[model samples]
Target: GENVGLHLPTLSVQEGDNSIINCAYSNSASDYFIWYKQESGKGPQFIIDIRSNMDKRQGQRVTVLLNKTVKHLSLQIAATQPGDSAVYFCAEKDNTDKLIFGTGTRLQVFP
Candidate 1:
């Protein structure tokens, strides 16, 4: 089990702007990573993904950058909006059936 206090979730973002989120992973063996955008009370949707072998991955209005050397990662959202607001989560899986999630970033859109 992980520390609960260190793993609290959610991030807040503004409307009509850009947002950058950070994630820290503890497992070195993880080889594949994905960034998912989840709206209020809904399942996660895959936005973008990157392999351990690759340093960067991009999608429409969204981008994921992975740094395996230091086990760090980031997600970038361009021109954020109210509809684009949600909880962003990063998942990692390496030959395992289950994926481990990072502390979620909650994007809040304000008009």
Candidate 2:
């Protein structure tokens, strides 16, 4: 997966059993959604994706919920561990060359 950034800061999360990352999108016309995970200093890895027509999408222990009516979304991780710790992000695209992404969520692994 490829991530496009525009000089934004980062959001941090502590290591734990589970974590919930929230995202709010501006484009109500957007119909595509994807959640990506990026480990320390690495490229964003595809976690899961959902089309606008779907309200929820899930992947190995991860779930992405889309609220099309309000244009809000969230990603939930289960049994979060050290190795599972990473920055998570949500993206949306609507017939555009690039997908818009939130700042980022960095999950810290505490030993």
Candidate 3:
């Protein structure tokens, strides 16, 4: 089965800088898109999501953008902080309605 994957295995960002995480999927049947943040010892926390019908969606300090034509997705974090450091994952709901996740990118925030 095809799955989603990240372009970068790790992303290094300075504190207070904006961070962008990229993901790609091969399945066009994916409808719902979600971004998740996972800390070292905790489960993945939902950040934001966008439906297939929508191109973009925004949260408090996060934005999720979906490009159905290119099968691409991105998550942008505004004013990234140290606490925002974690492994970020992009998930998509397949045709079967099962949530499929990417390989995940580790967000390293530096002061």
Candidate 4:
């Protein structure tokens, strides 16, 4: 499926600042959630994940939050760095156990 937006949203942040990337998922029954970071010429790498039973989960400098009520998911990157500059995607597994990914959001960390 497609993301909620028509165009890929971009989140610009300072090198040491925090970055928040948001995604609105379509399935209310989605039980699993994941946040992925994809650099140029590479596949998406796992950043963090949150289960439907939990509201939040943290990994390294990244955090994933899930709001089942609104079917919204968000990824927070603390102390963003130049290496954090990339396309981030949010995915969720619905009742069918199929993973559906969002359009993606580009995170640009500036000096």
Candidate 5:
């Protein structure tokens, strides 16, 4: 089975600052990668994604970067807000279309 894991368990950031979360995947064959934000007692929500072919992709205030060579992935959030506080996870989709989720990083945004 494929495995995805986070480099850090928690990250704390001040409001209006930037936040970065890191992840690592075991499946090098994975073609697609996705970053998700999960609020307390809620399901994960899609934030951004980057395919293996691309190095980076950006959304409204979020960015996803993939490094196939090192099997590393990262998510960058701009202007962190209280609402942005959540558990962030990175998921990888393999050739079989199976999605493997990481342990998740808890993002704590403080005023």
Candidate 6:
């Protein structure tokens, strides 16, 4: 059987510094990618997204980069803050519109 998904479990960063979270996906057929941030007791919030046609996309203080050749995705956060502390997830959407989420990465920001 082939593997279908992947993720990094945790990341720690210093407040006021930049943070980079990485993810690897197994479905090469997936076309859309989304990054989500989940706070305690809250639902996942949309942070950013990129399409397979694009190699990179940027939002406010966040950036998402996709490498189809390696089936890798990365999220970069500038000037990480306390509010940035949370669990982050990467999701892939196939042509069927089904989204498969990676395990998750808990981002801990220390002051």
Q: RMSD per prediction, one decimal?
A: 4.3, 3.6, 4.6, 3.7, 4.6, 5.5
Local lDDT at 24 for model 1: 90
lDDT of 4 by residue, 1-111 (tens): 323223668888999999999999998888999988888777888888888999998889988888899999999999999999888989999778778999899888899
lDDT of 6 by residue, 1-111 (tens): 112112447788999999999999999999999999988777889999999999999999999999999999999999999999888889999989988998888898999
TM agreement with the true structure for every prediction: 0.85, 0.80, 0.90, 0.91, 0.91, 0.91
Residue by residue across 1-111, what tens digits does model 5's lDDT show?
Answer: 112223547899999999999998999899999998887666788888888999999899998989999999999999999999888889999989978998898898999
Local accuracy by lDDT, each model: 0.81, 0.77, 0.87, 0.87, 0.88, 0.90
Q: C-alpha displacement of 10 in model 1, angstroms?
A: 4.6
User: Weakest 10 consecutive residues, lDDT, candidate 2?
Assistant: 1-10
- Compared with the true structure, model 6 gives a TM-score of 0.91
Q: Highest lDDT among the candidates is held by which one?
A: 6
The runs of at least 3 residues in candidate 6 whose Cα sits more than 4 Å from the true structure, single-residue gaps closed, are: 1-8
The better-scoring model by TM-score among 1 and 6 is 6
Candidate 3 local lDDT, 1-111, one digit each (tens)? 122223548899999999999999778988888988887667888899899999999889999888888999999999999999888888989679788988899899999
The digit string of per-residue lDDT tens for model 1 on 17-68 reads 8889899988999999988877656678888989898998888988888888
Question: For model 6, what is the alpha-carbon lDDT of residue 39?
Answer: 80
* Error at 21, model 6, angstroms: 0.3
**Which parts of model 4 are misplaced by more than 4 Å?**
1-7
What is the C-alpha local distance difference test score of candidate 5? 0.88
- Candidate 3: residue 11 Cα off by (Å): 0.4
Clashes counted in candidate 5 amount to 0
Model 4 gets an lDDT of 0.87
Q: Residue pairs in steric clash, candidate 3? A: none
Q: List, residue by residue over 30-81, the lDDT tens digit for candidate 2.
A: 8898888887568888988889998888788888999988888988888777
Residue 22's lDDT in candidate 6: 93
Q: What is the lDDT of residue 62 in candidate 2?
A: 88
